[model samples]
Target: MGENKNIILALVLSGIILFGYQYFIAGPRIEAQRQYEALQAEQAAIEGTENAGVIEQDDAPSLPLAVSVDPQTDQSSSGNYTYADAKTIAINNAELSGSISLGGARFDNLFLANHNVELNGEEKVQLLVPANEDNGYFVRFGWTAVDASISADDLPKATTIWTSSDTELTPQSPVLLRWTNAAGIEFLIKIELDEQFMFTVTQTVNNTSGNPIQVRPYGFIDRKQEPVTDGLFVLHEGPIGVFDDNLEEQTYEDLRDADGGKFESTTSVGGWMGITDKYWMTVLIPDQAKQLAVSNLSYKASGGYRASYLEKAASVPAGGSFETQTQLYAGAKIVETIDNYQDEFGIKLFDRSIDWGWLYFLTKPFFAGIHFLFGLTGNFGVAILLFTVVVKLVLFPLANKSYVSMSHMKDAQPKMKALQERYKDDRQKLQQEMMAFYKKEKINPLAGCLPILIQMPIFFALYKVLYVTIEMRHQPFFGWIQDLSVADPVTPLNLFGLIPFDPPAVIAIGIWPILMGVTMWLQQKLNPQTNMDPTQQKIMAFLPIIFTFIMARFSAGLVIYWTWNNLLSITQQWYIMRKESARRAAKAANKA
Candidate 1:
């Protein structure tokens, strides 16, 4: 009896640990995020009306070691200019639409045309914003002085307006901008784009100043303020890059602490660095053959985070010219597109931009299989269902053996109970007798847990895939499930949205979660209950309800998969239980 009780206790504890995290940790975080988003929206509306036409200055916060800074001043500088004063040049492409500011020749305003700001919304998703705004996030390129021959004034400043040869930038038609310094030195930038999100920028310097000048060319992505994050530890949502063949990921908090200081990797040969959001990325890709230093820093005065790189300085002789070509990737992180760039451009580990977690070996293949299924069906929800069926089929032999062993244990329950009662006072002897009886009946009690143990890692891997992949974001399933990446939108307390009243998160159970609970309850019925204590049986019976509450805020795709898996398990267990009962009855009749 004690031995059997220990097994029951172990199972109960496992279930509790799995569901406990949702209640004690994830539940409050979701509620806080909801409130924080609402507050941000309200603040943005107020700021738009109050701060209109005001020129917001850039933040030049202090840091420990600066990657690239103005040589004229020790402190960072923000230009005194308004959005109205700056001229904008449009970039219209099939996949991207935005404008470039002529003032700094910065690729600061960008939007993903295909991705919407919200599910089923008309407005497109914005990737880059104006430099004057509070949350000014953009990319900038310029030269850092390497020798005394070049002064800060000789380099193009953020306020320097360049003359563009073309009115607009397109995939086929590129734009060229040129500026000249006091000493007759000319700097020209030619920007080119592809059909997709890749941007090829070639910077050329013409030194006609009669004196050779030494300078280093560099580019950086800066965000004025920290953006909202989902706060899940498994997914990184800040600075990400591959330096010298090593992948480095730093969260927003980590960058904030590095303010007025420098956090950088040693000089590496062949890597790319950039800032990453949940679904989008803005990174600078240096030439793989060139040696460069990748660094991230936080500015204390401006409260901005930056990721930048500096290539080796070159000395341009008088009347000599130097030019180099680099690439910039700013768009949705679609796995296929990134992989294509990695193969064609020779960008080292570019696809590692996606957070593949520790189980990339397994998670990557799982995502690929599901993506293939989604391509055929055109519905992520349906693909998840089909994927569950395929997984169950693959594990059928192992599940079958587990269920058969469980059935044999159920058949020996009467003898086991008799032994328990006979040696009730001696706990050791009772355990010994139980083991002997299990061996005599050729039943391995531990075999029943094998399938469950195998499935746990698979479940976690699938969760990471759904959580980190952009392809799953804003995807629709059947009715009432528009975004499979988020929790089910329809809540039972609100009568599935007909009431128009938002319920608390604790009562936000959805229809799919209820169905999952029903299937779990049915599966439990098929399992042996004869040896369980009354209290343990009651606890086991309540597990389905507890899980239903725990999974209320999970992604709808995961809920659908769980419900389908439970139904399959119930069907298999029922068939095995019935078969064993009939065999026992037939043997009894033959003995009579």
Candidate 2:
């Protein structure tokens, strides 16, 4: 009874923590995010009327080419501009479709050809938007001068127009953009694309001038507005990078609160920096052998943020040329694709982009197992079910031992109750007698908690896999489950959508959660509950109900896993309990 009370207390505390976090912390944060987004929208409307497509350039970093201090006179700030306003080289590949802006040679327009904005929508998922758009997000590369003789005006700026060598960029053919300054230095950028998301950029400086010039190459991803994230604590959606083989993640708020709204890294031999959304990312990978510096910067004045990298200075002598190569990854974060990129390009910790939570050791392998099953089954939902069975099989021995212990405890329940009645007025005597009784009967009072404890990490890891992996996005289960990555859409609150009225998310309990609750309750019935007081028993009975409501908002795939696992546990425990009962009855018959 003492051990049972302790376990019950722990369970209650866990529930309180989960519920309190959801209700007091997550709920308020979501509401605040909504209000912040509304305020941003209102501000955007006012700014749109006043400035239109014009983006106010801040005091550009010293390592990058400086922008015009006065926005009114900045050439890049000139009137409303669109994709049609610039000369662009069309980019067409099997997995992507967009154009590279020739002006400033920017990767400003890109879309994932294989991914759609919605499950049933024809519109492709836009990854990068032109700088002229309201939420301008783009990647651009250029050279910054290290010598005093090479003025900022002489270097290529965002408004500088480049001549493209090719009309279109494809996997088979690369494009070269060329521009020349008045100093007679020719600047060139050769851009190559693979079938997937990677873009290889080679920037060259042909110093035709009689003087030797020193310059450093740099790349930047500028986002004009802070993106609205999912706001979940488990996932990250902001500036992320790997510098010196160390992973770094910073939120938009963190960047905004930093000193001067900036975070700079020491020189690293090889690294990649980028801004990551929940499912998409745009990363700049510098040469692995070269020394470089990375920075995450936030501009409060213009409401913009940037992730940038600057390579070490290279001296371009007269009649000689200097060149540097970098790579850009801009697309969806498919797990396999990211891993392949890391292996092929030697990108450090690229798989960390997926935000596989603290249980990465478990989460990663769990994903791999489920993904392999998905490959064979052709459906993520079926794969999850099979994976749950695999987990059960692997844990069968330990679970069997746990169930046997629980059965023995249940068989000794009558003796335990007699002891309780014998020592009703003596608490210390009851404790001593109960301990002796447990040892004599070979019963482990805490054995019932072992299975639940082991399942916790697995549950969290699977949840991470479902929430963060892009492969799960838009993947369907059986009928009515079009996307397993989201919560079950049908709810009994509105008669499974038969009624026109839609219930609030809080009360919208789905079918899978209810089924899970049923299975959990059944599983609990098979466990040893005789030692618990009436109040403890009542609290335990309500656990399934509390969990059902809590998991109602979880992804459908996770709920399915829980339900199937509970069913498996119930079957195993039932078999053990029945076997134990038969053995006890057979012994009694022999004694009679």
Candidate 3:
């Protein structure tokens, strides 16, 4: 009985220690860090240390010499959709540089694409376009064409270095573009116009100067501008390309976001603009360049989200030309669109952009892999099941060792109980004897708790994965659990014969928690506890019920994983117990 009191004391003390550490030490430290960051942001905004609205593309205005018959009309040969063959591709917003216009509005899209065109030899270059409330000026809502055109000969000689296209602005969907050579070279452009905007290349090459131009190219996104606000996070796509040096984000000085604000994901097919996806610009250039430049996405007038400019250099080998293409997305971060999109210009969601300790990095790959495997079956629940099996397999040895120890203690229970009765008055001596026995047998008293300790972090990590991962937001798990992120459904106060059903999450029709508790209870019953205090045994038995309450609110994916884990443990423990019992029986018979 006193031994049970000691057990209760330990549990209570642990609870108090946890509470104090949470409220007094760790809480204050995190709060202080947040407060400091907030202060710095406010101070920067107030002091005007940086220009809040300097769109990168417009830093240096383009010298677009205008020439036109009617500025108001669309310069198209096919009724309204096709544009005329003009050497100068007119951009609506003249300030388009490396920034984007979809900064903080309901619709936010920053487009950046890199393309490679084989010239005489393989040459690479980069193009950049950022769209933020502070920087992107490429999305001109209503405006006349700002002339952006240049000739093939205007470019310098090819340098043959790898590059990335910094600019490719489309209205909403990508404009279909093709390269044609009449005089020197011509580009047939097809743009899809929504009621919201217009797009054009700020400049085009006047081919009368030359011909057959072998162009080599790549793409880039110029995000060298300050963020719209200090508090906003910077989400970016991981560096993707064939070049080793260019794939590293650390090398770029101007584009770095210390806050780890850059988040990245890929596009789905068919150009569906849901609430959670973004877009990128596509670029194509000639073999090389004596000089090359790019800018952000932003609007030229009223400081909005659109911009257009021209970059011209490189002397083409008469009859040589280059062309690039991509779409501009000015929209929100929709989970459905991003998670399943294959069209891919790597879009990073908000949570991935946050700094959430080691968990952020560790769980990212795990989440992605699980999603990929289970995503194929269209059942995230099954995917989680497979995921659980893998985790248990990895930790199988640890569990096996623990089960073996438990079986041994079960066999020794008779001796342990005798000792307890013998040392009933001497609690300290009883504990010392038990410890000595355990030490001699090389068994750890804490073996039973080790699995829990190891599982807790993985469990927490899984929680984070389900909560923030857009992929699981609306995913279904069997019939009752429609959305894994929500809570379970149960009874409510009846208002009428209308008979209102409980919400899905509250519905006990879900069997995951019940199964989890049962497996846990069975595992506990199977494990051996020798000379255990009665109260300690009860607490151990009741633990599964407490766990059920906590786990019921978690995502179905998480509950499913735990359920599988527990069930496997039950089978393994039962098998180990049977084997150990048979061994003792054989030994007793032989001795007798």
Candidate 4:
């Protein structure tokens, strides 16, 4: 039997390594490799986009990075649209392109690495363009008009911007380009990048008309990235963001999220800003280091006011344009830094954030707070144990009740055995009688299990805490259990290097599982089963060995939880049993 159990343990060990490699390593490797090929394709695509303009003008920048709508060439040309139709904006650099539209005001485009765009409408007159677009649809928006410079105190107004496609881009004219002077109405608006990929562009209506006007902004810029799963952590805070040193150091040379150590990973503190038909991006992270609201991995968008959801009222005064500042972050979203940020911008990206009701609200915050406190202590294992103790203490009343009931139930096991023998044939009747007996004696068969069941969330939450958190990566502990993430080294894998499994955290060959199984068997004997039959007894005894096999290759953290829980439980049971035995003996002696 010992040999058979060792054989099973070996098989389980092999399976874990194989599964880890296949699911976590191999698959991501393949995807990252594929992304490398795609980034190369993006660079090649630029050639086709500029071929028309370059072929016409021999003096054009021989190499192509930015794509533009050529007014120098005829607009009648035709070609398939590719990502190269968009200019490659190095995430950390500031880039600007000024274009004078046909009989239009000169639009100066400025890109900041901190996820924001500043349109300095000086000397140039602003035009208010009504945004005509669909519901929940986000886009870049601006207006068209002759020079109409207006003063700040005067009612700011401008002519509507004509659109070839949808006039619904803005329900009314956007209020970004507010007039600083009375020199006609200077039209202006700004787009704020919300958390993650969501964009919120706002144009306030500043007016003394005693009424509020609401408008939406719209425009378009094509975005592209070769997808890769493996890299330093990624945080996508959309408007407000952050990044660790490792992630910030990535470059866009290959323009892919991941490469075969061949491509550079990059971050765009400022994403992309579209001016009229032209687009600009921040090529580097220089001045965009400090920020205002919605802090994430990168810096903040310090240029604008952090708008409120409820307090702002989401309304603008008529005749007066609304003023707002916006920031954008376009780059690989490092998940580790995002989680570490702990703000709303980072929290919304987690998969576990969407859990329901009171448990969802309470659990995530509770676990995160515990992690924060324990992470300070420099040991996750110790933190987990501390967290467990706190939870147990909070639920002590229920535990006390369960323990008392179990004390009664364990003492009655002899009587229950006698009843089973008496009603061996009438099983249904036996169950009814046993239930009545329990009610009469106030002995609960399910009492002890209740505390454990109630405590299951802490166990499961700790599992997620250990599995998902990158902080625990390669973290070491006392010898044998070097890494808390994996099980303690007790069993050998290769067994003389013959089998696939080798010694990991486990040190002793195969003693731990047998010992664990023995404890389980003893616990079962100490706790009585009132309504159980011969078949039930078989199952109860068999569970110990079954669980032993299951836990042999499990994580040290999980084993720690169970082992401590069981040992503590055993001590409690033994104390209660001894006291009860003494009490009965004393009562009998007094009666005699």
What local distance difference test score does each model get? 0.79, 0.82, 0.42, 0.39
Clashing pairs for model 2 are none
Q: Pick the candidate with the highest lDDT.
A: 2
Best model per TM-score: 2
Instruction: Please give the clash total of every predicted structure, in order.
Output: 8, 0, 125, 82
Q: Which stretches of candidate 1 lie over 4 Å from their true place?
A: 1-79, 258-262, 297-301, 418-437, 533-535, 582-592
Task: In angstroms, give how far residue 11 of model 1 lies from its true place.
Answer: 8.9
| lDDT (C-alpha) at residue 393 in model 4 | 65
Which lDDT tens digits does candidate 2 get at residues 497-542? 8999888777789999999999988877776666556887788889
- How do the predictions measure up, each by TM-score? 0.88, 0.91, 0.46, 0.46
The candidate 1 region of ten consecutive residues with least summed lDDT is 56-65
Residue-level lDDT tens digits of model 4 in 1-592: 1232334355445445644654466557757778777776676676564433221100101101121122111111222232222221111122211211111111112222332222222332211111110001112323211112321123221111211211111212221223332333334443323233222344444445454433222122211221232331211111211222212222322213233221111332322221111111111121133221111121112111110110111234455665443333222222333344324333222322212123445456555765665677777666666766666667767866776776677667788788879999999989998999899898776776676567656655554455444344445555555566554555544453457665532233333454566776777677634554576456556767666665665556656656656666566667766767787788779999
> Candidate 3, after superposition: displacement of residue 478 in Å?
2.5
Worst 10 residues of 3 by lDDT: 269-278
lDDT computed for candidate 1: 0.79
RMSD of each: 3.7, 3.7, 14.7, 16.4
Model 4 residue 330 CA deviation (Å) reads: 7.6
Which tens-of-lDDT digit does each residue in 197-246 have in candidate 1?
A: 99998988999999999877777778877777766666888888887688
| Candidate 2 stretches greater than 4 Å from native | 1-85, 297-301, 414-437
| Per-residue lDDT over 76-145 for candidate 3, one digit per residue giving the tens place of the 0 to 100 score | 2222111111111222222221222221110123222221222122432222332323332222211122
User: How close to the true structure is residue 17 of candidate 3, measured as C-alpha lDDT?
Assistant: 56
Worst 10 residues of 2 by lDDT: 65-74
